[model samples]
Target: MSSAQNLAEKPKYKRVVLKLSGEVLRCSETGDPISWDTLRKICNQVKEIHQLGVQVCIVIGGGNIFRGLSGSTDQGVDRTTGDYMGMLSTVINGLAFMECLEKMGVQTRVQTSIPMNQVAEPFILRRAIRHLEKNRVVIFVAGTGNPYFSTDTTAALRASEIEAEVIMKATKVDGIYDKDPMKFDDAVRYDKLSYIDALQQRLNILDSTAFSLCMDNEVPILVFSLNDSDSIKRAIVGEDVGTLVS
Candidate 1:
């Protein structure tokens, strides 16, 4: 069936920011940082969401390639310098992801916090919004271009700047669990939670700084696993697929 036909189901939000884990680029337990097969699958999912007529923005993590905070402790790299390296990793990830998306015939634009004009346009709020208006997927990368800031916080910041309806965090786990689902088979999954409840309960799905930004802005977030091929489509199509935090 055509993607348009498949996503004929209603979309809950008109505009959203999809937060991708760096693992999305990892092929497997032992594979290249960017696995073509996995990337193609992810591109296909994003295409379906675009076809649904909902505006799409994305913030992808860089843990698959490098992590700034880890380098400080493990490699004894200067914390500031390591964070900058980590930011660069995100740009590379964006480039690789863009290549796959273009191959799928999707129109996209990569906007970086730390502008490398030759590679991608600088992060321009109005320009990014215009791209979304034109149905072009905009990828916001480079993790706020600052040390000590995480991609999770970047997602929240970008979502607020773009006035996105919600932040859709794509995780490997199905949804927020009372405990680590993998470690405890009896862990309970939360279907719905208020922002205050999430904070009070100390849910680890979103970092405190990032979570606070969403709470302050009144942006709802949906956390769902990306393991299934149709999870993106299902979540945006208003299906009960993940934990909803409002």
Candidate 2:
């Protein structure tokens, strides 16, 4: 067997929390609603990881459906109200993802911070752990069920609560860059960075609150692009595919 196959057989982490931005679910190429193709692609990636015997939990953002910060200005809504709307958006994404995973033959569950019994289970820590132990992928929705808190923070909080080995942050960019990679020609990417360096230097890998919580809890983070095929598997297998922020 190859080294990658050997590492995959070992299984390093008992559990991990993946943070996916809602924008990733949307059809960015077509400028329409959620794309079935995009959803299927992500589902396949998750399915591949699930087959590896790694317990996976996901926290999805609502930026694709509704960005609170932008909604407040564009729609003339209050900040708190817009944020609440954004939280609901995450629930929608979670449900869609759950359906996709189920279709792929991967048993999955959706746990919402906000009580939505009709759609999913309530956010219970023990129940979540039990699901992981049973080899079910749990998708966490509703973004902490409160305003003024980003989903990035939710990822950290859930990781710490569930004792996740690492936080895999899925972003459009491949990794943390010194400058906006799209806007600058010479943006630098760090292979690995200390938690303090990410905070002090403001690397933009994650929100301040999320970074602080991860640092305090000693939870390492892996920032990578979800669009990259096999990237999730690479991350779980300890391959050098993205920026490692610990």
Candidate 3:
């Protein structure tokens, strides 16, 4: 069979947790945070996946607007305060995603680990499941509602809670490589990596806590480039489009 035919195979995942870094919303040329064009591109792709009958849950980071560790810390903000600020950034980002998805006519909800009654619903396991059951995309926000926990860990925790089949980690890079792909031209990308190898090699594709949660829960992770249009859809369809870490 042809490669295109192979790519057209039926989807294998019924439900998934999509982890998107806030950097995905940035404009490369102008370096403006929260580019509407970028946001729309991602939302459109998400709508496509939603139409395929997959229960979509998104976990977005705040690195683009504010990171707890960097920028804030370097500017005299203490770690705890900086992290809280970062969490707020994620809420803002989650609202942005909810707006974009709703505008596309995709049913959506923003559930925050940190409760903000006026802005979003609290993260309740049963409620989140019901939202998915009703075909509404759930956007998890606020980074576990705790300081020191990365958004990556939040994605893992929520995926486990939501009973998602897999965690689809979207990044700018095509996939996980042995070395920094941008700096090292000879860096090799792996098609599949065992959890043990990933840990032992210190792949750093995901935070250790997040990786551990997935390892303990036996939840597979697909690391792929968001630059590839329809990449999330392709991952759900079981295409060999990214590095699979399991």
Return the TM-score for each candidate structure: 0.95, 0.95, 0.95
Model 1, residue 36: distance off in Å is: 1.1
Put down candidate 3 lDDT per residue, 1-246, tens digits, no spaces: 797865575568999999999988877888987999989999998998888788999999998899999955589888889999889999999999999999999989999888789999999999999999999999999999999999999999999888799999998898899999999999999999999999989999789899999999999999999988788888888878889998
Q: Please give, for residues 1-246, the per-residue lDDT of candidate 2 as tens digits.
A: 898767555656669999998888778788765888988988898898898899999999988889898999999989999999999999999999999999989999999999989999999999999999999999999999899999999999999999999999988888888889999999998899998788778777778898889999999999998878878887887777789888
User: What's the C-alpha lDDT at position 80 in model 3?
Assistant: 89
True-vs-predicted CA distance for residue 235, candidate 1, Å: 0.2
Best by lDDT: 3
Error of 2 at 179 (Å): 2.0
1-246 in candidate 1: lDDT tens per residue? 887866567687889999998878887867778887888899899998898788999899888888899989999999999999889988988887788888888899999999788999999999999999999999988889899999999999999999999999999898999889999999999999999888788889788889999999988899999999999999998888989999
Candidate 2 error regions (>4 Å): 1-4
Write down the TM-score for model 2. Answer: 0.95
